[model samples]
Target: MGDTRWLSAEEMRAWNAFLAASALLNRQLEQQLKDDSGLSHPQYEILVRLSAAPDGELRMTELANGLINSKSGLTYQVTQLEKAGLVRRRTCPTDVRGVYAVLTDAGRRRLEEAAPGHVAAVRAHLIDVLTPEQITAVADGLGEVTARLRALGR
Candidate 1:
């Protein structure tokens, strides 16, 4: 306890900026996604991930890990998507305990419909606001932060 050192002014400023920006950005994107396609941010991400996967399918555990989400959370979201006819879950034939999330045709269509507006929202909120140098700096800096945290089992 005695050896604990608090953040300096600059460090505090950086940390605060990161926290606020990330939160606001997530909020903005969530709203944009919801408005554009009646999809939540996490749902949209699941669709995007599955769309890019081979055969538009991935294991439930893989999906959960890829999204940094809990298995149960992913299950709930997958179930929502399933109800919407946007996704389906399949039992892995070789492993009774394994399940897969498969993107449906409707999911791909919805993603295609949603992509342009989502891209524009992203540009309007973040990318277009930054210079190339700032973008690179952000990418490199956050990339390192993500790598370190992930390495720590985040």
Candidate 2:
């Protein structure tokens, strides 16, 4: 093992708090989606991404990248969505070598219905508890982290 530097008490506390808060937030959101929409958090994310895509469709690889998922995992998720009649997979005409996942009208409608409750949950659990300034700080901090991670992929 490489030489390790011990965390200070304050650092340890902050680290643990961050982990706990993230876990709790994720759990709450997942529960909210399950109760309100019969969808899991990841499923909601997939739908949201597809809805935001042009023509409500995205190449499978693009969708996978947006969701930070493996192709096989995305394929499985898409299969489930397809079975639910919310999404469909179509061969990419131009590419001939790729497939696109297209969000159906039903998928759009489901997202529209689920979004309000999801937003309310977010506000209740997170945003409503924070000042606007705190919200900005959190966004900026997280944006920086995301940027750094994406950069590392280059």
RMSD of each: 0.9, 1.7
lDDT of 2 by residue, 1-154 (tens): 3688989999899789779989999999999999999888878999999999899999999998988889899989899889999999999878898999999999999999999999999999999999999899989988998899988984
Query: What lDDT tens digits, residue by residue, belong to model 1 across residues 36-137?
Result: 899999999999999999999999999999999999999999999999999999999999999999999999999999989899989999999999999999
lDDT of 2 at 30: 97
Give the residue spans of candidate 1 off by over 4 A. none
lDDT of 1 at 69: 96
Candidate 1 residue-wise lDDT at 123: 96
In terms of lDDT, the poorest run of 10 residues in model 1 is 145-154
